[model samples]
Target: MSKLLEVKDLAIYFDTYQAEVQAVRGVSFELDEKETLAIVGESGSGKSVTAQSLMRLTPMPPGKFAGGSILFNGEDLTKKSESQMESIRGKDISMIFQDPMTSLNPTMTIGKQIAEGLIKHQNMSKKEAHNRGVELLKLVGIPNPEKRINQYPHEYSGGMRQRAMIAIALACNPKVLIADEPTTALDVTIQAQILDLMRDLQQKTGTAIILITHDLGVVANAASRVAVMYGGKIVETGNVDEIFYNPKHPYTWGLLSSMPKINNGEEELQAIPGSPPDLADPPKGCPFVARCPYAMKLCENHMPEYTNLSDTQKTACWLLDERAPEVEPPESAIVGGAKVHG
Candidate 1:
């Protein structure tokens, strides 16, 4: 697959009175054509911030681009003018925000919402766009699209609203789709439906997707690759199987361990100790060092460099250093009763 988006050394900071909050620090990742990359991290880990930056969606002044280049379709988005970004946003890349209720215009009919992009970018007539809007709704598995398109967002169920949001995003057939916690507010069944819909859409449109969420279970099913973020940085990245079956970073282990595992009789979920570090004054060394059970002195004094476990897997941790002690992940992190060596 060819590279569609390349975010190089991306950094975003929130300028506050007391300090500059380092929301994202030197984050880099690539999205391939027709592939789903899941950016998994806890709340405030900067995953959402990074996604927002792709389309220059992060608010400036209070939220500044500290550093980095977001290269989409061989152009640098960070340097693009607002006018230039406006052309790219819905036409080339689109976003399905976390909350459809707030993202969608409550007053507008579903057809109008979807038709807005088709009219603006594709220059379709109102009747043409309106017809296409119904097709989009049906494309996303919404029932009775023609009837539903005439109704407002309030008339739709939560899941249906989300589907409408997706329909609006795919209206222009953007090359890239950013779904930020797309299924967070939905129940399990609806979440599955949304995920399946996204996968089906990808198969049909060949649109590369960036799925941002804190859930590893979601990643396991929908993502082709995974990037684990913590303390405003990518601590680990690999294919889905590598991330789930052989994760290297302690943070990744903690996330997996915390997920509720089925068929593991009498096993309680293991939560990671301590909250994420304060980004305003981030730790001097590794951000996760304070909470890591096997943290060594070096881990507290310096941040570890990325170590290539394989061509497809990379992680940053002192434990992966040549001289560090060998330590296995805690039993609680073991998935399906199998160990993941460190």
Candidate 2:
């Protein structure tokens, strides 16, 4: 696998009447060809903002790139003008938004929506694009594609609409696909079907994916790597196994402890105490310090550097310091009945 996209020290901010809100602060990650990277976090943790930044989708004036570079296929996207970005947006890279209902244009027929990109990027004739649209619809598991292609978005079911969105995003055979909460709107069975469809499509098309969601279960099912974001920064990153089985950050522990366990009968899920930090008047030190049960005085005033736990695992926390007291992860953080020693 080769590196297809690289985001270095990316910082996204929103300018408002009150103050500048740091939506994404010094966030960095990479996506390799034919790989799936999951960015997992709660709402307002900057997961969607970070994903949007890759395509330069965040609106300016209110939203601005405060710092850092987004390099796609060796070209710096941050340096590209809107005209230049237009050339790359749907052809080289594409995105599947959270809600197909809101993202899809209501007036256009399903086939026309899918054909728009093909016509724009591939320079296909309307007839050519329409034919490709039917194939794309069929490829994504939509039945009666010939007839369904002529129907409006409102005519399709929720899952079918999402599949249509996928067909549109994948129409150009993009090298990278950014799926922001692709299954968040569907029921459990439909969610599973969507996930399976995405995996199958990846296998067939060889498109690298960046899946953004709050669900750790989805991450476990689809991603090979995980980046845990909180308070506008990536607190921890590792392979799926390391993140789920041997998480290092206190924030990561809190997230894991909150997950529902089937075997732990009668056990209540533990919620992380306190709200996330105010980004407008953001915390000077570690954002998790306010909610961390093991926070030290140092954590209140200073940020910690990322401690490398393995070739692929790293976390930023004062607890990993040699001088700081060693603490064990709470029993509730244990998954699959295995305890992680700190």
Candidate 3:
């Protein structure tokens, strides 16, 4: 797989009256063409911030791009002016948010909403844009695209609105799609439908995808690879199978154990013991050490560098360091963890 998108040393910070919050630390990763990369982390772990940073859409005064480069299709988006980014957005990269209502204009007809992108980015004529919007709606599996396009967002159900959003995103056949918790509020059936649509469209368009969510089950079914983020950094990363079955990072282990199981005899789902570290004044050592079950003295005193398990699998944990004493990850994480490591 060749690299299609490379994010090098990306940092995003927010300024406030109290202090500055570094939402995205020096994070780096590469995504390949037609590949699905899932970024999993807790709610405030910089997952959404990183996704938003890709389009240079974050508010400047409140949210600033402190440093680094986002290389998309051999060009650095970070260096591009807003106008340049405007040309790139919707054509080169498009994003879908968690709430369709907020992203979609309530006042505009769905047809016009989808058509706007077609005309702006694809340079289709008014008549041509209208025709293409109908086609896109049909492609995303919405029923009666011709008539439905005339309706407002409120007229459509949650699932239908999400489908409409997907139709709008596919308007220009972008090279990359960033879906930030796209299935958050939808039901199981709707979530499955959306995931299927994304996968099917990805096959047809050959677009790379970045799926941001905390659901490990979603990653198992959809993503080709997974990057486990914590405290504004990637704690573990590997192919889908490797990350799931052979996870080495303690943070990944906690995540796996915390997932709700079916037909299990447990009284209640087990939760991770501690809260996430403070990003404002983050710990000097491993950010997860305060919460890690297997933490050691070295873990508290120093941070770990990225340890290479294979060409495709790497993690930032002292457990994988050659100098540290070897220890096996919990058996519970083995199913998913070993899939990556083995």
Order of candidates by lDDT, top first? 2, 1, 3
After aligning candidate 1 to the native by TM-score, how far in Å is the CA of 178 from where it should be? Answer: 0.3
lDDT of the candidates, in the order given: 0.90, 0.92, 0.86
Location of the lowest summed lDDT over 10 successive residues in candidate 3: 333-342
Q: Write the per-residue lDDT of candidate 1 for residues 1-342, one digit (tens) a residue.
A: 778999999999999999999999999999999999999999989999999989889889799888889888788899999999999989999999998768889999999989989999999999999999989998999999889999998999999999999999999999999999998888899999999999999999999999999988789779989999999999999998898888889999899889997778587668898999999999888988888888888888798989999988999998888788898987777777543321
Shift in Å, residue 261, candidate 2: 1.0
Best by lDDT: 2
Residue 128 displacement (Å), model 1: 0.8
Runs in model 3 deviating more than 4 A are 336-342
Which one wins by lDDT: 1 or 3?
1
Q: What would the per-residue lDDT of candidate 2 be over residues 1-342, giving only the tens digit for each residue? A: 778999999999999999999999999899999999999999999999999989999998799999999999999999999999998989989999888778889999999999999999999999999999999999999999999999999999999999999999999999999999999988989999999999999999999999999988788889989999999999999989899888999999999899888788798778998999988977888988899999999998898889999999989999999999999999888778543221
Q: What is the C-alpha RMSD of each candidate to the true structure, in Å?
A: 2.2, 2.3, 2.2
Candidate 3 residue-wise lDDT, 229-335, digit = tens? 99888889999877877788999988987776654545477778879887877777888999988888998878799989998899999988777778876655545
Model 2 has a clash total of 0
